[model samples]
Target: MGSPPWAADPAPASRLPATNLLTIEYPGYIRDTSDSLDRALVSLSPVAGPRVDAASSAYALAHLTSLLERGGRVVECRLPSGSGVPDAMDLYKHPILGDVTPSDHVVVRVHRQVWKRMVNGQEERRKHYRIEVLGASSTCIRFRRMADYAFRPEMPAHASEHPTMKLHKILEEMDVAAMHAHRFMPEQEDYYDGQGAQRRSNLAMIPPPFFNRQELPFYYGYRQNPTSSLQTVTFASTSKRSRRTARKGDADLLDAGNDHAEVTRYLNRARWRNMAPVAVKFTEDGPVPTEPDAMLAQMALSERQLAYLERLKKHLSERPVWSRLSLLNQFSVADARALVQTKELFALVAYTFADGPWRDALVRFGYDPRQDMASRFFQRIHLRGKAPRAPTTRGAFKAEYGQASASGKAAPAVGDAQARPATHLFDGQHSTFSTSTFQLCDITAPVLLPLIHAEGPSDLRSAPDITTGWYSMSAWEAIRSSVSKSFHALLSEAGPHKTSEEAIESSEGSGAGDSSEEDE
Candidate 1:
């Protein structure tokens, strides 16, 4: 058979500008067919052409030049098979054998193979041809693997020897030092996102001495209004190097008078310095004070803390009982350290209920629950197994609770009662408490129980056992007596009046008994 058409001499290089030429390396093999060769040439055609103007062609050339400089690699080109020539092509349309001419600079090689295939249960002989275009060695780039010194050993050793033991020991000592240093380090301020999730701050990376040093403000003038006396201050960068670097571009534009623009206003200091620093004290024992007397005497309140205390007192005066989460949400204090400060201030005017109807809540010192049986705050209902299904309407709640009583099921324990409430118990006044507060308790603990108040059967009071339904009057009396004793003990520990006579006089002079009656 005669030599294939590609075996002929290559055509002269196109007269296009040398700068506009792009060299594409086809590293993969292509089937030596008329259609396959033509598709390859079509896919590799220069993106810029006669239809593209000189300006657009310049941009395309710059883009390709950048890609080549940045170590761009060859990507396999995918072309459609068994398709006719495009309508825009005026050249020979009928499968032109070797009519698709490439630049003479391109080098091509051909390979042939003989194979056997089964056709109609008979062995058939087949001849296969593949073509590969070899790019010039000068244009082809190869990347070498970078050496990693971290994994290499300074000294060679046998397989039986432990070469990494020294490195391991050093790393272990470093880890221990890091952990030990944490105990001595003061607590870092925490940041909070809009959703109230705690996030770590990077401010600790700054040196302590940097905060103590005062910085001078930088001023710059604009050329557009040179007579204007106002000088713009740079709030972001205080260093001379940064100021010089920032003004370099502005200086060029101003001297050239190319794009001189007027400055409207300087940066606002309040926006950048909005964060308030909270003082945190650390001791060898811990952050929390062990002795109440020391905490009351040494811990002086700041103006901000005193204002917060007054706001808290006003909230307590309006309502005798408030959940911890509700108070936090009201004040918008989400930080853990800030919450600790709030708890310390709260202890001065109120005390937490460890258990009972007011669990996880703070009751004002003078407010008593026994006299408020008619109030919804003092009411509670018991249910069996994980909290009842949330009822959407008042009728649904009545139906669910009423049916449970009719079925004669055993009452659920206090642990079960603490399960997430189906409906808002506080009339949706404190939305955050309804979801976050109750979930913190152990729902499976048999020893500790929760106090939940729900609108249920009117005859719930007749249930003989407190665990079966509502709490009895005797149970309330017992809770009142226990709470009174604990409150008094807390006062005696923190109050300045130490002697029995002084304590009696302090109580009588303050009219503690009269205040309780008035709060009721």
Candidate 2:
């Protein structure tokens, strides 16, 4: 009652007697096709069992199958025709197995077989199998005894040594000398001996920065103040290394020689690197008023700026127009510091021509290039050689200008007559004429000065003549035609002995016969 039959102790299992069984292995699958077994048995007989002829191979197979079934369970497994068992068996024919013969027929040894009972109370034995065939050729057939070799699973692939491991070892043993001797290292001797000389020659040809030490006259009086008081305090040495050494030794007896050398080296480097020109900052201290009076009242202009403005106006009044370089040259000689704030001072009294005949020239604000015949006279003329001698005699002048006017062309103006002689006299002395002559083109259109907002009688802004409608195409053409006529008449006055190139050069050198003095 306490322990039921369900909990009874389990009986010891009986062991089956061991039998010596021969497993006759086939190299591939065995199919149930007619003569399939007979052919296989005949081919395998020479290597596996007793030798049998083709006529008695079928009887030999039946006897072998019977003996195998008596000792062990004879199993039949019906595999699908598409099963890849035949292809897997082909792997055994590899050369690794030693002297494998190629066979059209594949053999498979039965390991485990399955049988099924049908619903109709019938015992079904599944024995049908399939094998791959290349062709019907007899030579394509292969035969082998499936021995202990076929039962061995494929040997695991051996792990290969990394390719970089050897390179790593070589690098570990490499020294600085070995690295320098390697093919990748640049040829140092060739670089320093041959290419170095060539490089130095090339560098010598290049003009050194800041070699032209001619100080800009405009910035003569302008001095940049040190940002901090510490900058003004000069020490024996500024270098970190020098100071460190000085602190360790007698500080009062610091070596001045090393400090001087350091300073020289720094100065050289600073000179080379300081290529950018000094820039003047024009600061707006207050809001700009539109009226001239209001601007004068509110503007934070200094006495120096006002004085410079008056000087610029005086120069402009005398000539009306001047090239930027010529103005600089004149101011540079007269008062080197006068144009320290050149751009700012010029903005008040004159406006520069951006392009056209008077390009780069500062014209007085009121002068209009469009209507001014003088502006048209200045054209860029490329002169190849030296200028011809000017006509010294009055007879020569009459023969040229007087006869040209008599031929119905316009006569040259009195201003033109007088100005030409003066330009000729100074043509040789002026550097402008030595290389190329610079002429000021007459102002035609009025230049707009956005910076100038003077509204009183002293207003610098030149009002355009709206009645003429200068903006119109017809008006523009008329202006252009008038300029051309005047320009041609002026050129005709040059003697026939002068070539076109010489005439052009002469006209440029003459400064369009304007009485304005040439820039010194």
Best by TM-score: 2
After aligning candidate 2 to the native by TM-score, how far in Å is the CA of 259 from where it should be?
A: 59
Models 1 onward score TM values of 0.22, 0.23
True-structure RMSD for candidate 1: 32.6
What is the RMSD, in Å, between candidate 2 and the native fold over all Cα? 34.4
The prediction achieving the highest lDDT against the true structure is 1
User: What's model 2's TM-score?
Assistant: 0.23
Q: Can you write out model 2's per-residue Cα lDDT over 22-94, one digit (the tens) per residue?
A: 3333445667885566454543322221111222455545654563446432221111124422322222232
Worst 10 residues of 1 by lDDT: 90-99
Task: Give the Å error, residue 274, model 1.
Answer: 34
Q: 419-480 in candidate 1: lDDT tens per residue?
A: 22332222212121123122212121121122223234442354333222144454434333
